[model samples]
Target: MTDVTLSVPQLHEWELMRAGAYGRALRYELPGDDPHRPSLLVRDTAPGSTLTLLDTEATPIARVRVDGSRTEPEGTWVGGVVEPLREPATPTFPELRPVETGELVAQATLLLGRRHGRLDGTVIVVDTGDAHAVSQTVRGLRHDQVDLRLLPEPAAAHLEGAARTELLVHLASVVFASTVHVIRGEAPAPGDGLVVLFTGLSGSGKSTVARQLTRRLRAETSQRVTLLDGDQVRSMLSSGLGFSRADRELNVRRIGWVASQIAAHGGIAICAPIAPYDSMRQEVRAMAERVGRFILVHVATPLEVCEARDRKGMYAKARAGEIKEFTGISDPYEEPADADIVIGRDDADAETITDRVYRLVMGGPEPDYAI
Candidate 1:
């Protein structure tokens, strides 16, 4: 079978990639990032092929159909939003653009041959999904050179974790970079429990849901559960921190750190923090994923609804200019774009929401909750 590869920039993309792996049952070890902030996968879809987005429990949340030419990403989906691919990716990926490889191949061979004392044997350069273009380049480069075999490496969707990394590194080594001093580590053992992180606006019932979920999990399941409420965390773990974005991120990270530790020991870490940024939420997700499973439950109560539920009158104060840097008022609260489970005030009752969360945690069937 030919291998296929796609660069995953987010947690949802990674998850989708894993789900679409050959046989649909293979596993991969997720990487770790800042425990200081909280955090958070995808797949390559062939033209005319459909890809479904699922949660950690393998429950379908949405579906996307690949459209347009194979080289370009264009799709339409039902149920939720999926980010379109961005060209000229990022600073770390300047070489990952969609230029014609005919010129690139000639340039690469000359440079690589010069550096590595002439290329020989079977050197495979993986070409993401532009296999035809890459293959043409390799064939062009190999003209009459029988001893030098430059093959276009196939898609590598079947490769798991370190193996996938190693292959990609090997591909880079053959063309642009070397894999010297690259240390490959073993995949960590899967933790027995999960860390359910509730992130959203203040008065979103994140704390309430987290506490109630903890209670339900303890009563219904044998897994140990721990609640890390935002108010308590701010007062204890982040007493001196102000409401600046950096400080808020740090506070969220502190909570993530503690939650990760708890999850590592096979305990459910239920955290409800007003984690207002996507980056921090992803940071926390990465931290916990390395040690245990991480589930992002977005208590997606709207700004108006949250304000109405605000018992502290913080929203009113913020509107009156008495409070500063208040999220959803003076400051922005970035919503989770790819949350595992999303609950809102109008969605269902507390009991129903808690039950849904419990089902997801236990790997049971997910309700048809529209993202």
Candidate 2:
């Protein structure tokens, strides 16, 4: 039998089809000239031939029987599930830490009862962004005959055809259940960890504002506060990295990872970096959000204003072609469209700007300071 490897998303799509979520007449298409496309196998395989489907780890997950009797588009296939060897494996997410084992099992048990009506059969639940270790804990625990499965939340939850029909059936049953017990509880308190990221041009006052904010937070709040200044972090954590685009991105990611760790522990991390690319900032946001709250502060100082304030003559060297990949001069800076707070160069004085950010972080008025 021929073998084909499918990505996680593709595997989910295939599983949906196998579960009759797509009608019998519906066919899947694999376009493009890519050799890995399943269309190649469909064209060559004869009717009734079988193909093995492998996951990213090369583990066999299912088998597909080609129905060559059916005609399809130029690059498409009409395949049916011959057998499903095993359930789709969950994607590995190493960066997130595991939740408490007991808490995870309790939550999984509740979800199983609510969704499946019994705790004996296989039950799939959406992952709660915890690390793989937490999911493994569920496997170690014994819950009578229950088999629990964890699936990540789909990027796009909308479904068509039979899938939608199945969802509607589930919802209707849930609504019309004979005994419905509504459990009420207070909203969860905010997480202890907080990541405040400052992004702007090199000569912008982001570093200065970050330093002041760090001092203020340390003095005012009981939470531990750490400042990750770009230059200081470069000299220590990201030492030996160059100014290339790849290296710069790596440096920013490293800073974000460390900040996320601090946030995970219920501390405050203030980061000041000229994160020129929107993609880099988004990556940082994702990392921080998994563990705690993430606040992005964009210091929107104009490029000309920043150049005028460049006392180090770095901008001059970049304009003279002596330096390559400089952020405002050579490389492009993608301004953030999702900044929680934006401070222009002429917005306000440092104290006023610092006070405004402090209030937002505290969710209310600033506390009085001690002499």
Candidate 3:
């Protein structure tokens, strides 16, 4: 902590806010002026407000006034917004409730941190009428991410590190400077989530169906949902994995690991792979059943239909010299003997498949199977 003092002019800028002290309720001019007209009334102040003042510390602390009469601030002061004491964070914080109209009514303490004034090590306190900015305050008070404290003093001495910022202050400052969106909601229940392993021949609409299911689930429910589509997973988490039989098993196994975690947290995980062997599907099923839910949707589309609808020309390539060992043509697809649900692989209409899986997994009212 560095020690310094403000110039006379900057010192004068120390309103109750900057002075790191609670303030009295009074309406001020929007930009800069005193609002002491006949119609003006200051009842209480709100959080996320700015105030101006004259630094009377050097001059003389006058008798605090309420309305036009002498008053006691400590008695009048209700309580500042309930501010969470923070380390690097100061008083103002994760407030969400927006002040509709700014009418100064009452004042409360705004707690901030200081390099010096360590009263119980407290830095500052601002007066806000009723605490309306709890969320904002909380966001600001979050502990710093990169833990410099973990570094030993000797290690810290040798390393050139960035200046420390309090978690709450830093986050609030960021929200104040940039766009901040706070989204919150509930989650689904156990056995109320779908974990489909779309298995079929290559070009069997496995990825297409899985992608659409993810989109629809997100749109329909507030619950968390994740898609473990084959191609995308291969590129990212399983980048080094390949198409060999052994490699494929490992790849599906990896997907199961992630999916199990997602489902355990009450998220629906939809997996679409050419999980040709029943052994791999069984592994995924065990993982899902142990945690949240599992519904194996076999897109039982026939080989001929899949070959005809080879949109990527994968089947044609496999037949020619261009490609090797494909799922349906060259390799094998051991069908599930006891799949939870099986959809006609030939159909591209995603709604039918989505409804079936949704019902079977969630176990709410059975969706109309009329389709």
Candidate 4:
């Protein structure tokens, strides 16, 4: 039998398999659109072949047998595993803890009944700002627990007045397993800290808009405003990083972490990066929202428009094969479906773009910009 190897990059995939969501079948998607040039696992492996699944660290996670079955929409292969793999000795991810759903529900119900005399009309909100936290909390939950709302930390933090106070008291009481007193005072101003992240192509004017917005915030607002522009950040924060997919992801993550720290300390951070991957953008949003609000601004200037406005001749270099993995030329930019604001090509002028962003940051209604 032929032996094949596959790499699993995400933890959730393994978790799904562990939860028996995939049953005995394994489905793998081929990398590109070309069906003729499939990977070795898809093209060479036939029935009775052995498939070895490896994690990112090159550790063997599971073994499967090829079933020679094809899935829908083309370029997907299916195999069957005789039994589930054993758990790793050292947890692949130490940061994630297995959420005890039953215990959590029991504690929450007991606390609510003790405090309010009943569970009716009571809602338990789980802070799901982290992706791993969300996955862990969600996978173990039963369908009957309708009162539990898994919201992001920022949304849950937006609770005000009596609702917010009740949540805090309940959390404290549950943690301590005893009565706890809460000293209420004036809440902190909502506009104190946040991250405004701008994403688009390299020449999509996001950096310009970010710079202008930075100037506006510094001139008008009392809070500290830090601008983490792409070129400047690459020069300083990510000096030795290359332009490969892994390096680009690491660079964006570094920017996200620093921006999160700034937001945590009651400082606004304006960031402009060509964050092409949706996963990376979601990661940054999650990191920022754990500490403060996060606004994703998608500068939706068309690719041709951006290429035309390129002043540094980078686009030309990319088209001439001088640059590899350049976004919009050799790489892909995944448009965000969760953008809080979309700046279209019509909002061309710097002042108009900056004003739109400024209004959003200063607690104004989000403008109806088409995505």
Candidate 5:
């Protein structure tokens, strides 16, 4: 197969936002680094066809890359800019309300808001601006059957066979696609506040930090705080699981799945897991984002310290002959290359680390106490 080359639009990290056709908002972000790797524009320009059209006088398109290894420097990739709006940013995000081709484009507008919280900047159209732009967009989208090329949301034709069936199903299900449902009777969805994830080696004080932070969230704000600790889960939730890589992943997935349920119900999920792998972390983050929110907090802990506090002597057992595939000892731990907030990454004590996670999570207003 010949390699195809495409010049895609540039994407920036901090200065990006997306507006759905249903008036819902979508924030453009990568799982990790490269501030400029998630662009929303591409040029498959053709005669009487324009690929880049401005919906309004101003629109914003951004670029970002997935989270990478913690030890490596942050960087972005350059791929063709056309990607299917995977699962849709929201329900009305892709199909556009009333479900039609042009509707998505008309309602989908990228705003290049003024730099640094300003909204007076020039807007570059997101996906062909209108009908003319859509017609022009058909150029690069040229494909045979089984084509996987990405197109402007508005250029998408839900009129196809499969799409049509899905549309009918969706019609039968009267729930709005872009609707935001608060979690439980308390927890706030990403639409409510920031959802931060806590990660570390076991005994690295994840539960400690989660406990202290929850205390603050309860005292300071009315936000309903919840704890999904490892031991608690290992017993009730993941009882049948063991200490294998696959088991660990399954456990983490269950944790994320439950946490997503919590965040979905509008409550915070202060999770404490040895979430020893980057892929697992990314998977959880996607789960959180797919709904509305997810924040990653790496409780950087030293192996020596964790081993010292082995309280349960699991580390000693692992060092002996009783343990297999222990995280940070036998099994490889893919340290988070890029995380939203880092705590105790550099040998900070439990008390200090607890303070940092608390500040990062709830923003420091509680009675600063040590673990």
Candidate 6:
């Protein structure tokens, strides 16, 4: 495979991964002894599209690239030396220093505004060697009402399909006020795309309702639907978590991160977690609101009915003291004081329940069942 070297002043530590962890190590060459210095060389290995980080010494320390399967970074092949990148000099951003130019662009914009009045005319230019990064930066600035436009690099055009989809989150999270010209047309406005949160007890059929709702949305509408079911997320995103309150909250947060990504990209995220705490659910709601719309659906199936519907024998086990901290049995399932939609345990079919959720997602009239 052919390798092309590109020079870069700095790279975000979270952008590169090593054995499932981020923050790559770097070695300085003889003349470049100042670790705080900004520029470095990147060796782009073709055929696999891997980006290798070479220090001033020209020694390979780390290799990174956007993983096609995930919006987050993955581990890379590399040596063991690590160093921090130099902070960019932004005279305007004294309160909020400019860091690496990427997805968190809007966050930096907000920080700057909070410390130094409203940023009505602040212009932020981002060149991260990727068009998606530029699009995301523009969108983030727009979200903060920052006036800006993207200056696209010729080499960064013609991104792959997966890379394009991955960049949509950045674009969605940032740009809304100003226009950005892309090979694929303009950045989409953060539309009515909502994070529909379904919170209930362990046996409350929350996951089942979410799955049905997802299917209905996919079949009936042209919009994309991503379902983050509790059990499945526990296996993948929250694999190491135990059933403790703190661990459970962390699990919900992980799910929130994924849902936020989906919501930011103008898609519907149906999350069905046995979220027993209202505070944690509120946290997830805030996360979604930063990028798109948020809706909470409380599956109000009673405890007795839920226990009766528990096919996994979880309720029985919890009652027998085998399972500790089981919601509705041992742990408390805090009901939402204010829910957008409440699904009561009645003879209503799955279609009826799904229709109710779809209505809420589409901003339809408030259902009679809402509390």
The most accurate candidate by TM-score is 2
lDDT (Cα, 0-100) at 16 in candidate 4: 36
lDDT of model 6, residue 234? 90
Taking all chains together, the TM-score of candidate 3 against the true structure is 0.46
Model 6 sits at a Cα RMSD from the real structure of 14.9
Candidate 6, residues 85-134, lDDT tens digits: the string is 33222222222222234333333221111122234454534343332334
lDDT of 1 by residue, 259-305 (tens): 98788677999999999888788878877775678889888888988
Q: lDDT per residue, candidate 2, 1-371, as tens digits?
A: 77666533456455444433333433343333322112222322333476787875788987776655344532235445456788666544322212112122222221321232234433334343434323443543334455444433221222445553344333212222222222222322446799999999998899988999999999999999999999999999999999987778779988998998899789999999898887678878977886689999888888998998899999999999999999998999988888888885575788888888888788774333210
C-alpha TM-score for every candidate:
0.53, 0.59, 0.46, 0.55, 0.49, 0.54
Preferred candidate (TM-score higher): 2 or 5: 2
Of the candidates shown, which would achieve the greatest lDDT relative to the real structure? 2
For TM-score, candidate 4 versus 6, the one ahead is 4
Candidate 4, residue 64: the lDDT equals: 60
142, model 3: CA deviation in Å? 31
Worst 10 residues of 3 by lDDT: 147-156
Model 5 regions lying over 4 Å from their true place: 1-190, 345-351, 363-371
Q: State how far residue 169 of model 5 sits from its true place (Å).
A: 21
Better of 2 and 3 by lDDT: 2
How big is the positional error of residue 334 in model 5, measured in Å on the Cα after superposition?
A: 0.8
Runs in model 3 deviating more than 4 A are 1-194, 345-348, 364-371
lDDT (10s digit) by residue, model 4, range 1-371: 43333322133334333433333344433334422111223322343566665543456666666555553322235445434465533432333222222123333221211122123222333333343433433343423343432311112222446664464455433332244433322322332469989999988889888999999899999899999999999999999999988778778888998998898778999999999988778878877876689999999999998988889999999999999999999999999999998985674687887888899999899988653
Candidate 6 backbone collisions, by pair? 25-81, 25-82, 29-56, 29-57, 136-170, 136-171, 139-174, 139-175, 140-174, 140-175
What is the lDDT of every predicted structure here?
0.57, 0.63, 0.48, 0.61, 0.49, 0.57
Residue lDDT tens for model 3, 117-214: 21221111221211222223333333322100000011011112231112222222221212222212222224444466777777667787788778
lDDT of 5 by residue, 168-279 (tens): 2232122222222111121222344345677888788788878777777778777677788888989999999998776787788789878876766567777888898877
RMSD of each: 17.3, 11.5, 24.2, 11.8, 16.4, 14.9
- Where in model 1 is the C-alpha error above 4 Å? 1-189, 345-347
1 against 6, candidate with superior TM-score? 6
